[model samples]
Target: MRALRRWWHDTAGDLPATFWYLWAGILINRAGAFAMLFLSLYLTEARGASEALAGAVVGAYGAGGAVGVLLGGVLADRWGRRATLLTAHLVTAGLMVALALSRHLLLIAVLSALVGVVHSMPSPAFVASIVDMVPEQRRSRAFNLQFWAFNLGMAVASLLAGVLAEASYLALFLVDAGATLATALVIAWKVPETLRRPARTPRGVPRIGSTARSARRPGLLTALTDRIFLTFVGLTFVLAVLTMQTSTIMPLAMRADGLEPSAYGLVVALGGALIVLGQLFVPRLIDRRRKGFVLATSTGLMAVGFGALAVADELAVYLGAAVIWTVGSMLAAPPNAQINADLAPPELRARYQSVFYLTFPAASFVAPTLGGVSLQYLGSAHWLVVGGLGLLAAVGHLLAGPARERRVAALLRGTRNGRPATSASGPMPAGGPEVATDPVRT
Candidate 1:
């Protein structure tokens, strides 16, 4: 008991107070995150929409999210994190209420998309704030704890959403909106702006230290242009596609094998259980390892797990596969965030994060489409393809290690030297190049 207490203390201790407030806000917000989860059902059951229209509306939401994240990152950099987060949260709450009260199909669809946009806009800001506040040495643990909080909140939401939905779909919307408002209030009351503003010269030019505007202001395109960082983003997209198979293809495969929906639900629940329970321990296990090695190991585990799905027919076999991939997920979460943080310049951190955030929406679209095609054509062989992708990602992470390390070292050196930092590709030249001054609320 004493040892367990010590471990708990060590795992959860030492993060800044503001981070804890942010963490608490995350927990509160996610605990009522139900709109997307039940959107289709609400459309069909309450609004009497056709399945095709419902699906389209959901797709529109996702598309809006893709746009939202990029916009959010830029806003976080320009308007400040506190303002962007507050605006997004409040806007999200308003949209949720508007969605519930909305009756027209077109209006409903538009509201859904708006909700997606506002809700997703905060992601880059949240991650960028974490990176800004937490020191590099403790980031792994900080990210792990943050990830754990996310999963924990999600678990509660899943359970509470069902209960709330039983009362009325209105409850879901109202509760989600209320929770979002709560998050906004928390940020307004507790969280301060974390974005480091560049000092201005007497002539009113933004400059970093003695460099006097050495690097051009990094725009969203900068992240896309950095070859090394782009490589990392691409690999992460592959990982997202692989990870998505659990929700997209796994159940379909199981149903084909004659397992009941209950069994499938149980299997998925088990994976969620493992994550909520086991993720906190992972930082301690992998924090000391090279980021490349940790990522490689994680992808390898995923490869093995998803590959085993090729033969997973029985309940036991399915549970075993869940265990394997869940373990991989535990390993991957912290390092993924850490590396993303490591690669981002302070000026462009949110933009880089937004680019990284794009992977999930992209993967969500790609995975189901590709997985369906693969299952139809390749049958069980689809799992093999999934496994192969995981292995490819693992290999990519390993090969990218040396370059990534050097880039991180360079970034650290530049920061320590108090100069404008360069990105992974190379030195960015002086003065403004295509700097975007237009604003959008995250």
Candidate 2:
């Protein structure tokens, strides 16, 4: 108890208003997502939709998310973070209300897409806000705190939603809509702007754009074309594929094994509980380590966990697999953001984050459909195939050895040479710090 007290005291600090506001909003919004707990069941049992149709509706959400992420990045870069976030919440709130009122399949699909779009809009801005508020050293801790808070909220929401669904599905939507409105209100009133714009040149001097055009230096597209950044994005794509298998197929597998809804709920609860506990220690374990090494190890652990799931039939075995995956998830969460933070210039941080985040929506788009198809065709053996793909992605990271180091070195060298240390074009110089060193604790 004394140690816990001391830890709390030491970690206490002022976080950005945006962080608290967003965290609160997440908690509220997630609490309302109780409907998601039974969305598949609702569509299949209540609404009488085909399995393929349900998958399409769910997958369409991902499609909308992809579009939202790209647009959000550009808007956050151009308009500012606060505005983008506020707009997203407002739009999402309306969509939730619409979804609650409608029953037509096509209308539901459209509303789901809108919900997905607005739901994703705040992510880039929110993540960029964290990067802006915290120092590099503490960034991982800060992100971990955010993840912990998010999962905690999710766990609560999932439980409550389940309870509410047993009462009324429409009630779940109404509750969720209310939460979204509350979130939007908090953002509008509490969150501050965090977007960092580029410095303007003197009136007589040619604009940086004109100069870059003359010099033939590459632009944002060219900078993103970097081998390391692209590699990380590719690996994240694979991780997304593996992780989605749990949400998409695991429940089906559990049902096949004779687990009831309550039992399946317990399994999800356990995973969330593990994440909350694991986040507490994972930051300390990876303290001051290279981001790449942390990421590689996490991905490898995830592969092992997924592989275990392929063979496990007993509930205890499934729980054990969840524990392994939870650890990997905790490790992977912070460093993923850290790497993107390292790669992006201060001015373009939000844009880079938005683009990097594209992988989530992209993978979401592919994973559900593929997982469904695989399960329909391959049955239980599909787990092996999915786990194998995760292992392959982990191996890819291993083969991409020292790429992070090389990228950092190049970034530092470019900075030292004063070669327009911008992210719109050009490579990061070498020999700089590999991981961000500041604590994001607040």
Candidate 3:
């Protein structure tokens, strides 16, 4: 018991107070995250919409989210993290209430998109805040703890959301709104603004007090133009697509093999269950390891797991595959996040994060479509294709390793010297040691 307690402390201790506040807010918000989870059912059962329309409405929400992240990233850099978070959360609460009361399908669709925009707007800011607060050496542990909180909240929501829906779909919206409001309140009360502001420059005169002109804050175009960062983003998207397979294609394949929906649910739940239980130890496992090797190993494990699905017909086989892929996911989460942070220049961090975040929603859309078509045409051979893609992505990470290491090293040196090295975004302002270093108990 003592050993376990010490291990837990080593893993989760020493983050800042504001980070804990953000962490708690995330947990509270996600615990009641029911609106998206059951939106299709709500539309079909309560509002009398067809399946195709429901799907389209959901697609609208995803499209809106894509726009939101980009907007949020710019706002995080411009308006400050706290303000952006507050705006997103408070507006999301209002939209949830509006969504609950609306009856018309078109109104619901429009509201869904609006809700998606406001709800997603905070993501880049939230992550940028973490990068701003946590020191580089301990960031892996901080991110892992954050990921665990998210999964834990999600696990709770999965159990409670169904019950709330059974009672009244309206309750789902109200509860979700209340949770969002609570998170907003938490941020308003506790979390401070984390966006680093540069010395003010006169309009059109370009009179800057600091010599760090890169601090002028570049737009999303900067992230788009960054070749190495774009390479990392592309690989992250591939991993996202591979990860989506467990939720999207795996279920269909299982059903085709005569398995029941309950069996699939149980199998799928295993992955989340594993994450919630074992993710805390992830930082210890990946600590000080080479980022490329860690990512390649993770992708390889997922490849083998998904590849095993080609022959999986029994419950036991499915569970074993779940274990392998879940471990891979656990391994990948922190390093992927840390690498994204490492690659981003501090001045353009939020924009870079926003770009990184685009992968999940993009994968959420593309994976199902591609996986569905491949399953239809390729049969079980689709798993072979998935394995091959996963391996290729793994190799990509390996080949990209040296260049990434050099980039991170240069950024670190610049940070220590109180100015960023000249790179794709040009000379970046000093970013290290800005946040207070006082350790806060978790």
Candidate 4:
């Protein structure tokens, strides 16, 4: 018991109080995250829409999220983290309420898009806030704590989503909106803006290249121009599409097999529940391992999990696949966050996060649009195809392995040699980062 307590303190004891609130706030919101849980089911089962069109609606939501993430990154840099979060929550809350009242297919699609735009705009800013607060050496622990909280909330809400879905689908929408409203108020009361804008250079005056480059706050254009970073983003998109299938395609398959909405909900909730139970220990299990090997292992687990789903007709079979992929998702979560944090220059931290985050929405757009059509025509075999893509993505991770090992070695050497470690994002800032890091723990 004492040893466990000591580990917790070492991992999270020094984080700032603001981060605790951010952690708590997101937990509250995610606990009510029922909208997406039932979105696919609701559209088809309740609204009497065709599977293809339901996928389109879901895809539109993802398309809007991509736009939101891009716009959010710019706003997070140009404005501040607090403002971006508040705007996203408030607008998203209003839209969620409106969505519950509407039944028109076109309007639902449009609202889904708008809700997507407003709903996910806070993502980059939220992640940047964590990067700003946590130290580099311990960021894996920091992200693990945050993700643990998220999965804990999701486990409950996802299960509750099934319950609420069984009762009244509209109730899920209202609960979701209420949670966001409460979250907005909590943030307005507790959280402060963390992003720091760099000083603008005087026009026509030649500035030092290194200094100008250091201070130049990058945006969407600057982020996308990097070829290596784009490769990372593409790789993320592939894995995301495989993971995203549960939200759109898997439930449809289960329903086709005669399972009820609640059955799907309980099955899907296992993913979050497993993460909640195991995320903390999973990081420990992989500690000191090479990042490339860890990523490859994760993708392989997901490939197997999703591939197995092609043959899952029974409840136990579905639940088993959920456990496999959920562990993979948890194993990969912390390293992925650490990688992006390491990738961000102070001037471009939030925007870089936004760029990487593009994969979630990108996967959303691709998974549903393609998975929906494929499931319609190709039938259960579509899961096999999705599984193949997961494997291909795993192969991509392995191919990138040598370069990754070299990079990790160099960083280790630099740290041991009394030089500060650098990243693909370049040298760490001298002392003051984009946000203050003093711990406010009592």
Candidate 5:
């Protein structure tokens, strides 16, 4: 008990009031996140749309998200983080009501797309806000707390959604709208804007925000050219793909193997429960470990989890695999966020976050299509292939993790020496193109 108390205190110090509010707001929004989970069913069964049209409409939501994330990143940098979130949430609230009231297929589709646009636009800013709220050392713990709350809300929502979905989806939409609006109000009232805007700096004196502005930012294109960051994005996307397999393919495999739908639900709920309980414990325990080690371990667990399902027949076995992957997911997430935040300079913070946030939509867009195709073609053998892919991702992260550390350290060294940071190559000479400093992030 003494040891546990000490660890908890160490992992969680006093955070800002705004951070707590942010946490609460995120929890509320995620709890009512019922629409996307049930949208397909609503379109097809509830509204009597053809499968193809329903798919197109669903696709519209995702398309909007893809666009929204990019737009959100720009908006965060251009406007402020709190402002961007306020706008996004307000619009999302309005759209949820509009979607609930929407009866005609055309109107529903348009509103859905619009909803997607605003709905996803807040992601980069939201993550950025968390980073801004916490100090360097507590970032992983902060992110883990946020991540845990998100999944907790999701788990609760998933359970309630089925029960509520049986009655009226309108109730679901209204609740969702209410929660989002309340969250918007919380941000509008409580959370301060965190984005550093460009302002005129004196010739010699350096203001903090001004220094952020003067970092010779190469814009989104320049951010894209960042070798270490780009590599991180690629690896994150791969991890997202593995995660998608759990959602898309795992269910299909379970049903194909004669397990009931409830079996999958039970497995998912159990996984969520594990995350809610273990998220805080795992990251704190492993906080001292290298990011690469965490990433590698996560990928290895994913490989093993999926590999286990490929052979297991019992529900017990399936649930065991679920637990393994859930722990793996929790372990990898905070480090990933920490790394992304570390990679960006204050000037390019939002844009870098947006680019990093691109992994989700990118993975979302690709994963379903690819997994569906693979499952359809490979029949029973696809799980093994996925496990093999996870193994490859593990190897990739192990290699990339160390390489990322080297680059960040070198960049920090360069910055301390009054030189701009170099790319992921050898030691940069003085006055070389400078990079923003990032030490031990990711």
Candidate 6:
């Protein structure tokens, strides 16, 4: 208990204002975003839409997310992180309000797509901001804390949505919109701009772009094309195939077993609770291990969790599967952000994260729809297929092998070299790019 208190105190010290701003946004957004989980139910029960039509609407949302993520990254790089975050929240807030007021299925579908785009807006910029504010050594822990905060928010939101949705569906939309607007206000007022001016080059030196900015240095595109990034994207795509099955198919399985909607919310809350608890300890426990090994182990456990779900019958057994899955997810979450941060040059951090996150939106675009179709066709037994795919993802991550592992390690080492080492850092070594510095202690 004493050690735990000490750790908490140390982690809290000197955190950047940007961290709090981002955290507020996540807490608000997640706490009210439970509407997405129950959207199918809302459409079916309230709008009298068929399951097939509802599922199509959900697919449209996922597709919009893919486009939003790509656009957010470009805008973050061109405009700034603060601008992207505020705009996304405002857009999403308005869409949520529109969704609450509308009854038309087509309009709801369009609004859902718009919301999806805004949903992805804060991602790349926020992630880049975290990397900028925190030191390399503390990044893993910082991301873990951020993940925990979000999950806690999700748990609360799920419970609130479950209770309120039982009374009124429109209430959920109103609450979600309000939270988003609150988050936007926080961002605009509190978060500092982390963007640094690029280093200047000598007059005689050939310039790469319009300005002699070091942050705009070439070779970023080359880094993006590296085999390491490709392998990571491939691995994430497979992971998405497995994870989306949980959101798309698991609820149907529970309903088939006669679980109440409230019980389903409880199940999700249990997972979020586990993530909150696990994030506080797992990073420390695995601190001495190779990140790849940690990733492999966590993904392997997820496969086991899904397998448990495949066979589970009793409510207790199902909840146990949730526990297992949550643990794996908690372990996996911090590394996801850290790996991207490690891979990026300081100048292109936002771009790198944007590109890295693209795999999720891209994979999501297909996985959920496919999983829904499979669930409709295969019934409850489809979970076994999902479990099998998770196992395959674990194997793929493992097979990325020593070469990929070394590349990531090298990048990590380069990041630790203080000044940026990538050619993308600047045109000249003397006046190379500087990473944004802030007081994010963790």
TM-score for each model: 0.82, 0.87, 0.82, 0.90, 0.84, 0.87
Q: Candidate 6 at 198: error in angstroms?
A: 1.1
**What are the Cα lDDT values of the candidates?**
0.77, 0.68, 0.77, 0.79, 0.74, 0.71
Q: Which residue runs does candidate 5 get wrong by more than 4 Å? A: 1-4, 40-59, 101-110, 198-218, 246-264, 307-317, 376-380, 412-442
**Residue 379 lDDT (model 4):** 89
What is candidate 4's local distance difference test score? 0.79
Ten residues in sequence with the least summed lDDT for candidate 6: 433-442
Candidate 2 vs candidate 4: the lDDT winner is: 4
Winner on TM-score between 2 and 5 is 2
> Considering TM-score, which of the candidate structures 3 and 6 is the better prediction for this target?
6
Clash counts for all predictions: 0, 24, 0, 0, 4, 0
User: Best-fitting candidate, measured by lDDT?
Assistant: 4
Q: List, residue by residue over 137-227, the lDDT tens digit for candidate 1.
A: 7777788888887777776776666566556888889989999999999999999999988665565443442222224434877787676
Q: Over all chains combined, what TM-score does candidate 1 have?
A: 0.82
User: How do all the candidates rank in terms of TM-score, highest first?
Assistant: 4, 6, 2, 5, 1, 3
Of the candidates numbered 5 and 6, which has the greater TM-score value? 6
Q: Clashing pairs in model 5? A: 339-442, 420-434, 421-434, 421-435
By summed lDDT, the worst window of 10 consecutive residues in model 2 runs over 433-442
lDDT of 4 by residue, 33-71 (tens): 779767888999889999999999999999999999988
lDDT-superior candidate, 1 or 2: 1
Candidate number that wins on lDDT, 5 or 6: 5
Clashing pairs in 1: none
Predicted structure with the largest TM-score when compared to the true one: 4
